[model samples]
Target: MVGRLRARANASMWVAPALILVLVFIYYPIIENVRLSFFSWSAFSPEPRPVGLDNYRALGSDPVFWRALGNNIGYAVVSLVFQVGLALVLAAVLEAYVGRRLRGLLRTIYFIPAVISITVAGMLFQFLYDPHIGLVNRFLGAVGLDSLQHSWLGDQDTAIWSVIAMSQWQSIGYTTMLFMVAIQRIPAELYESAHVDGAGRIRSFFVITVPMVREMTTLLVVVTISGAFLAFNEVMVMTGGGPANSSQVLGTWLYHSAFLNDDMGYAAAIATVIFVITLAASVIQLIRAQRRRVET
Candidate 1:
């Protein structure tokens, strides 16, 4: 009993640092933000004043907030389509069609952008989307589509989409790599059995590959959704939520309100909303994963 107790005590000591860090950095900020949401605070002011639900009430009438929320939803949808969907397709094609020798090279090429910092990617895209000197407009003109070339980042209609495209470029390869890893783990005998059953590549892929990678697909979906909501640095470096706030997401809007508009209370409310949404998504994902584990 004494030896067992001492061993468990040593294990507890090893975990204590991580537990303390999580409490201080993660839990404390969440609690503080929640408390701050019910008050009126400005950076210039000496202290926050309790306003109960006034900040949240103001959110209901805030058109900018609504626009930002819409943009965030749009971003999540786009991320799902391009990041998760495209990555799955790419991984499938590579695993099924591409030769083993070429696959590694191709994967490295695709995954390069994922390693590049988002700030660098944002800056690079800014140059690419530049109205006068951008490669995008240049390519359009080269293809004799001059009439179609508008300011990519400056136009409200195209600004958010441009950001989405950049995000896809930066992330799709990472998603593809994840899916590829999962796909590679699937039993090769399953593919052989399908082939002996006279299944074509396309049919085998649908029947054998897709179902096997369900857990990876679920993980990517949750990650992509959370990333879409938490996106900030890219927007900050790219649009600054501009072209008249058309590209604003909840993250950038919160920054704008807190620092620029000096409305920390409203910003806290926005943060709380974002937290609830992401937390709910995480909880749902956890529950679904647990159910899957139980069934399996």
Candidate 2:
């Protein structure tokens, strides 16, 4: 018993550093952020003044806040459609039909954009969306589609969607690769058996492939939604939440309120909202996963 206690102590000691880091960096910041949300403060101010729920109440009345939240929801919806839904289909196609060598090459080509820095990607797309010298406008004009060309990022109507399009280009490949991995894990014999039973590829995909990849789908859904809500760098680099705040998302709005506007408390409230949303997504994922485990 004494020797077992010593072994457990040693194991705990090995874990202590990581635990301490999480407490200091992650948990502490989360707690501090929540605490700060109830106070009115600025970086220049010596101390935070307790304001109760004033910041959150202010959020309810803020038009820009609503606009930013709506943009986030829109972003989430688009990501779900393209990044998760379309990517899954693409992954199935690549896995089921493509030759091995071609599959590897295509995956690498697609995933290349995901590896590029978001800042770099954002700047590249910003240049591409340029009204005057941009490749997009240039291509449209060259192809006799000049009527379709306009200021892509400069206009409020197309700004958010333009950013979202760029995001889909960068992200779809990564999600497709993840789905492909999940598909690969499925037993080959199952596909062979389905083939023997007269199942076409499409029928087999729906019956076998989709069900087998449920866990990956759930994970990707939660992650995509969380990331959509947390979107910042792309919008910042491309639009700066602008064209009259039309493209603003929750993250950029939080940054605007805190650093630019010197309203740290309100930013804290915004942060709290983001935290709640992401936490809820994670919780839902966990519950679904647990339920699946129970069913199995």
Best prediction by lDDT = 2
Which 10 residues in a row give candidate 1 its minimum summed lDDT? Answer: 281-290
Clashing pairs in 1: none
Give each prediction's root-mean-square deviation over alpha carbons. Answer: 1.3, 1.0
lDDT by residue (1-296, candidate 1, tens digit) is 99999999999999999999999999999999999999998998899999999999999999989999998899999999988888999999998889998999999999999999999999999999998999999999999999989899999999988998999999999999999999999999999999999999989888988889988988888999999999899998999999899999999999999999999999999999999988898889878988988998
lDDT of 1: 0.94
- Candidate 1 residue-wise lDDT at 174: 94
Off by over 4 Å in 1: none
lDDT of 2 by residue, 132-233 (tens): 999999999999999989999999999999999999999999999999999999999999999999999999999999999999999999999999999999
TM-score computed on alpha carbons, candidate 1: 0.96
The deviation in Å at residue 95 for candidate 2 is 1.1
Q: Give each model a TM-score.
A: 0.96, 0.97
Pairs of residues at least 3 apart in sequence or in different chains that clash in candidate 2? none
Against the reference, the lDDT scores of all candidates come to 0.94, 0.96
